[model samples]
Target: MSYYNGKRVLITGAGSGIGALMARELASRGAEVIVTARRIEAARKVSREIRKQGGRAIPMLLDVSDLDSIPAFRDRLHDKAGPVDILINNAGVVFGGEFEKVGLAEHLNTLQINTMGLVAMSHAFMDDLLQATRGHLVNICSASAFVALPYGSTYAASKWAVLGFSESLRLEMKERGVDNVAVTTVCPSYIDTGMFEGVRNPLFTPMLSPQKVVRSILRATKHGEALVQEPMIVRSLDLLKGALPRPVWDEVSLRTGVASSMKSWKGKH
Candidate 1:
């Protein structure tokens, strides 16, 4: 199915990393893509590349962390393209610091961009998406949402909030018979993105490729899958947590060196 063909899709954090890749991929597939980031130059560069590749896309300045900026963001999008058919909340952050070492401001910053920003953007576009009668809200979460490892308490908390928020939104949408408007949550382990440039993962699970993630997300959304976990193994881990007691799993995880490996990576990074 040419699911993305002619679809109006808006992607945040589209200046670089997975967001940039996703913008290119979707646009290549015929989607009318609108990408946003804090830096206008980066967004314009990516948009230019997409257009050069025979795709439809435009660059816009957006700082998801700033709620006040959303109206202007929406206005720009509205002027360029009416209501978006797909809203991809792919912007996020990860700060590697001890729970206590990470100050309140930094922690709040994490929440602002990784959590609240997503919520605000989605909410801002809700009226448009609803008017379209058929649209998708895809929230990019992380495997960290499942478990909090060393030095990632804050990051994990933000992601966990995303997971919870997505689930609740799903329920609310279903009850309202908003069948045409869907919500999808993507939870993947460490992606080979610069965000985790100095970070490490001990799970030994293969990191996800940006292109591969985009493929999965597109396929799953087209197939009507409510959630897409990039690596199937992550799903198994989720199940394992439920099967085993929390304390037992925690002890095993720590003894298995996953925690240590994470710390070691932090030290090196």
Candidate 2:
């Protein structure tokens, strides 16, 4: 849509997986993208690839876990390009292990990147976004946000926080007369990214492709949708999980071996 044309989009975790896919898709559609990754070299490579395709892209070194880097990132961003029109909080980490077996440091790091990072980045750019009025903030959440699996307790907790934060922010923005600034949250099933590579889905549910997920996000942003859910089947399952009794659902989860797969996946990797 014309709304996306020439939009300045800022995305985190843009080195690979869904983050990189979204960057390429947005650039191809006429958006100037600013991509940040923990690894500076990976960011540069992605930037180069995008440029070679005749798209506008700039790479920056960013580690969401490192709070000290935010101010510098903000300054460099403002110096290079003006305020970003769209912010995609897509950087995240997953530590797979039995809840009791997982170390406190790993759990804390997961929360730091997935939850705290989103909050800090949004606050750092809130003023600019509000001034623009016509802006969008997209948070990439997971199906874990709705239901917590055995090994994903930490990941699920972080995403649940994100889901709540995004919705509440949307409401606050509305009261400020910044109706044009849309906040959309996306929840998808396991992706084929290396982070979750060896994880098996006992149900044989086809893992959603990052590209398709990106397209759905763009579509939602264009249409002003508040929430974007991929693979209608996944959405249905979410509803089912909520409607069923907790014990029953827990049994289904245990019997399906969903938790075991995620926990065992760590060793396989």
Q: What is the lDDT of residue 246 in candidate 2?
A: 84
Give the alpha carbon lDDT tens digit for every residue of 1-269 in model 2: 66677889999999988899989988988899998999999889999999999999999999988887897889899999989989999999988877778899989999999999999998887777777747888999887777676787888899999999999999887887678788999888777777777677746456778778888988998776788876675576668787999899887777776656686665324
Query: Over the stretch 79-167, how does candidate 1's per-residue lDDT look in tens digits?
Result: 87788999999988777766787688877899999999999998999887788757889999987788766777778889999999988
Best by lDDT: 2
Candidate achieving the largest TM-score: 1
Over 4 Å off, model 2: 202-204, 267-269
RMSD of 1: 2.0
For all predicted structures, in order, the TM-scores are 0.94, 0.93
lDDT of 2: 0.84
Report the poorest 10 consecutive residues by lDDT, candidate 2. 260-269
- Candidate 2 lDDT for residue 2: 61
